[model samples]
Target: MQDSNLFDDSQLIFRVLVNDRLEYSLWPTVAGLPAGWAESFGPASYEACASWLERHWQHLRPSGLLAKGGGRG
Candidate 1:
């Protein structure tokens, strides 16, 4: 069953995705996931997901990219 309240700002649900390049993204669970990406953590409120991101995604560039000389600075 779909709950309309879940779509509201306060209870918006989201998921975490990481690409081959190791980039972090917040995906809407309702939209589903895209190809070549997998879920890391999810089905949580947006704020909760954001907090997780803050704790984990310290670097913007992927480990592979940085090793390949693709750093921002």
Candidate 2:
């Protein structure tokens, strides 16, 4: 994907958003990210989000998992 068109409105833009539970989800840039979620990596394509999740979501469990603590803990 060309960097110039990454933000173009025609393509499906994706944002790697995380919720309070620290669960990660692929959010469409066309929609507003849910209230409590924050952008981890953003304004990318579906492939980008998928690739990122594959690389970084080593532990599928939410970070808020009591066994793991929360917020990057």
Candidate 3:
């Protein structure tokens, strides 16, 4: 049997996770979602997740900071 790397394996499905800070991450569906993170996107291909992040997560700053008028000129 061969060991497979969940992150690199395209055969496996993944979902996008968002924390309170509004940071996004890609997580493998086979594993349990970490604390303080919720599913923002559905189970799909890694490429799809990447694309979604590119379109949605344009600003890298946390929502709290943005709310506080930070990261602005």
Among these predictions, the greatest TM-score belongs to: 3
Q: What local lDDT does model 1 show for residue 5?
A: 46
Cα displacement (angstroms), candidate 2, residue 2, comes to 31
Q: Which runs in model 3 stand beyond 4 Å of their true positions? A: 1-5
Q: Which stretches of candidate 2 lie over 4 Å from their true place?
A: 1-11, 66-73
Measured by lDDT, the strongest candidate is 3
Over the stretch 1-73, how does candidate 1's per-residue lDDT look in tens digits? Answer: 8556433554568988888888888877887689989998887888888889999888887789788887695
For all predicted structures, in order, the TM-scores are 0.76, 0.69, 0.81
lDDT per prediction?
A: 0.80, 0.76, 0.89
RMSD of each: 4.9, 8.2, 2.7
lDDT of 2 by residue, 1-73 (tens): 6565433443688999888776888878878777999999877888888799889878766755756564343
Which pairs clash in model 1? none
Better of 1 and 3 by lDDT: 3
lDDT of 3 at 59: 90
Q: Please give the lDDT score at residue 16 for candidate 3.
A: 94
TM-score of 1: 0.76
